[model samples]
Target: MEQRLSYLKQHLQQNDIGMAFIQGKANLFYFTGFRCEPHERLVSLMVFPNAEPCLVCPNMEVSLAKEAGWQLDIIGYSDHENPWEKIQQFTSDISFQGTMLGIEGELLSFSRAEQLKNAFPLTEWTKLDNIFMDLRLIKNEKEISVLREAAKLADFGVEVGVHALQSGRTEMEILSMIEFELKRKGISEMSFGTLVLSGEQSANPHGKPSMKTIQKGEFILFDLGVVLEGYCSDITRTVGFGAISDEQQKIYNTVLKAQLDTLEMCKEGTILGELDRKARSIITDAGYGDFFPHRIGHGLGTEVHELPSLNENNSDVLKVGMCFTIEPGIYVPSVGGVRIEDDVLITTDGYECLTAYPKELQMIK
Candidate 1:
């Protein structure tokens, strides 16, 4: 903890940044070790260059914040005392005059930012998106351990999903089955909603569960993750119901091979974008390039999507202890889609595969 504090302090000093005000849930947890409330409550975490960080929250959460031993100072706000006034009173006393403050650009809203500007007009606000992104690119020992287990729980969820995927099963029923299995594996909370799509609906990556039932020779897509100890793991696999056509089998094989080939090239010091390109190349060569439209993969940690994205534009280098997912897909619109995802950890030598569920085409005939 002390080392982390010193590291952050030195980073702030080197950058000549005055303070980092965090409003997002994951950001607050990473900087202050407090993650109870969502970002909606107007709570902020202020990290100064050489002093103990502080947390601003509602009056009811003051005790809970104290229990976490995160913030050195806890400022409280109440409904009786105007929330905005309390915020101004608290920040006005701080050493914020003429200081260049950093804020989470994407997570902090325009309304809340306006409030901060009105509170301290002299203090300039800089976006901290790149700064935080760099900090969270590499994972720590504690983080990797939890994510490994989360991957196992996700694999367990996949087992349930495959079993529930029978002919004539509704999308809602399949979701319930996966949730029950996740709970059975000790994953009480989900990192995100379990996605269940059958037949033509499977082509949509973010499609919600519907009343559609499984159709013979059609594709079924399942994307799910389990949260264990605030960490997350995500995996996606497309299976066939009943007898599958040879074309579907060929497509599934192509995606699975692409994923494995990409993982083979992922090592410490590898370029993130290159890894994404490598995956894309294999799928493109197989003639399913147009079907695979999204980025090859993304970073995985405290939140499912963190930093150092694995895409064409990201130039971040892969490092040891960093965990991310490789999900390559081929969506044929109304015909169906095939995507097989796996959470992998960059190791000192090569890469470690965390999701051990089966990737071969499974027919639930």
Candidate 2:
């Protein structure tokens, strides 16, 4: 945590930013090793260029923050108290005129921004998103270890979902089973809403699970991830409930080939855009280009979706220690959808497949 804070302080000094107010939960955890959800309350980390940093949170969480290894000064406020006023009191001794203040503009609410403006009326506010993104784009050994564990849990989630599949089972029923099993294993949160779209509903990329019963000879799509140790893992697998048709098999094969081919290119210095094109071209050649939508992947870490978007238009270069997902799908409104996704980490040589779930088409009996 100290090293991360030092890096941020250097950036502030270089950019002439006197102080930075980081409010994003992911970022707060990144810099302070403390994860918190303040909901409507104000929770932030105040970082200075040459001075010690301070954490601000509700008085109730002050002890919790200290327990999380935050050894710095903490400014705790009550619900009836104005947090901006508390922040002002803390910085009253520091000079603000002709100096710039940095903030997470993307995550700051309008009302909070207004309050901040009133507190530091003479100070200029600039975005600190790029600084935070640059700091978090790469993962360390500890982060990778946590991610690997999360990926394993994600694999287990798909395995449970596959086993719960039945000819007469509804999507929600299977979805509930998956979560219940995860809870038994001590997983407290999911990266996103558990997706268990079956049959025609599977054709909708972001469809919601319903009470509709799944039938044999249809496709069942399971897209889910578990949050473990402050890291996240995402995996998507589509399986056949019973004997599927020729067209469905062909579509599934095309998606599998695309994902495999793209994974082979997950090496250092590979352009992010080319990975998407590689998968897109294969699906297009198979005559399902239009059916294949969305990017090839996205950066996975503290947040389910992070930096370095893997799209056809992204020109960012892949580097070692960067982890992301490789998901390729073909959805046909008339024939259901087939998607295969995996969590991967770029290594010194090539890449490591974090999620170990089988990629081949599975026919659940």
Give the best candidate by TM-score.
Answer: 2
TM-score of each: 0.94, 0.98
Candidate 1: residue pairs that collide: none
| Residues 1-365, model 1: lDDT tens digits | 45665677787788888777877877767776666754356678777786777778888888877776664878788756666676566666765567888888888778888887887688877887787777777888888888888998888888888887766789989899889867766777888889988878888878888888878888889899987877789999888888877778888899989988898988998888988898888889988888888998888887898765789778878888888899998888767888899999999989998999988888887
* Model 1 deviation from the true structure expressed as Cα RMSD, one decimal place: 1.9
* Candidate 2 lDDT over residue span 64-98, tens digit each: 99999999999999999988887888887654445
Root mean square deviation (Cα) for candidate 2 = 1.0
Ten contiguous residues minimizing lDDT sum, candidate 1: 32-41
Q: Which 10-residue window of candidate 2 scores lowest in summed lDDT?
A: 90-99
lDDT score for candidate 2 against the true structure: 0.93
Q: Which residue pairs overlap in candidate 2's backbone? A: none
Error of 2 at 15 (Å): 1.4
